[model samples]
Target: MLELRPNCECCGRDLPPASVEAMICTFECTFCADCVAGPLGGVRPNCGGEFVRRPVRPAAALARHPASTVRVFNPAGCGQAEAAR
Candidate 1:
């Protein structure tokens, strides 16, 4: 199951369970559309993998599964993410 991470790793933007603006990689590395499209350039910096839109977990399902609350913000921001990876 998808972890449905709660925020963008780069910009720290909120991305709720049903957010259409969320993107993720194979490792469930979550990011906002802006971060993926702009700074990260549609690739996951850590994995060097292409990103896909994160699916919204249905509200009813979320009650049982629960989206993750852990926030993974990049202190150095998105610009340095590629090199850091």
Candidate 2:
């Protein structure tokens, strides 16, 4: 199942379960469309794959499937190198 990440990986924008702005790579690396298309504070995740939209979690089912708190963004300064390029 999709992690339904709570925020945009690149911008830290809050992405509630119903957000359509959340996009994910095959590896489940999440980012906003702006970050996917534009320079995200200088990081383009090196996921080595393309991104797809994250499926929304049914609100009522959340209790059965708790959300993951694992946040996956580029490692701090390293992202800038991607943006600089």
Candidate 3:
């Protein structure tokens, strides 16, 4: 199951469970669309992998399997990735 992380790892933007803006790499590193398209340039910093739009869990299913509450903000990593780009 997808963790459906609650925020963008780079910019700290909120991404709720049903957010269409959520993107995730294979390792489930989550980021907002703005971060991916702008600073991060569609590449995941940690794993150097591509991102895909995160699938939204249905309302009823989300209730049964709650989305993650953890926020994995990493501004430094984002800066590093941008610099490397």
Candidate 4:
């Protein structure tokens, strides 16, 4: 299951369970569309992978599955050195 992370790793934007703005890499590194499209430049810095829109878990399913409470923030955006790899 996707962790459905609660915030943008790059910019710390709140991305609730149903947010259409959330994007994730295969590793589940979550970031906002702005971060993915702008700073991230359509690439995941940590894994050097492409990103896709995160799926929204239905509200009923969320009650049973529960969205993750952990927040991941990368204030520097994608690390330049890491991205170049």
lDDT computed for candidate 1: 0.86
User: Which portions of model 2 show Cα errors greater than 4 Å?
Assistant: 40-44, 75-85
Off by over 4 Å in 3: none
The lDDT of each candidate is 0.86, 0.67, 0.90, 0.86
Candidate 2: deviation at residue 85, Å? 7.2
Q: Write the per-residue lDDT of candidate 4 for residues 1-85, one digit (tens) a residue.
A: 9889999988788999999999999999898998887877888776778999999999999999999999987778565534565
Clashing pairs in 2: none
Ranking by TM-score: 3, 4, 1, 2
What's the lDDT for candidate 3?
0.90
Candidate 1 worst ten-residue window by lDDT: 75-84
lDDT of 1 by residue, 1-85 (tens): 9999999998899999999999999999899999888878777766788899999888889999999998888846577545554
Query: RMSD in angstroms, candidate 4?
Result: 2.1
Clash pairs (backbone) in predicted model 3: none
Instruction: Judging by TM-score, tell me the better candidate of 1 and 4.
Output: 4
lDDT of 3 by residue, 1-85 (tens): 9999999998899999999999999999999999899888778877889999999999999999999998898888886567776
The number of residue pairs in model 4 that clash at the backbone is 0
Clashes of 2: 0
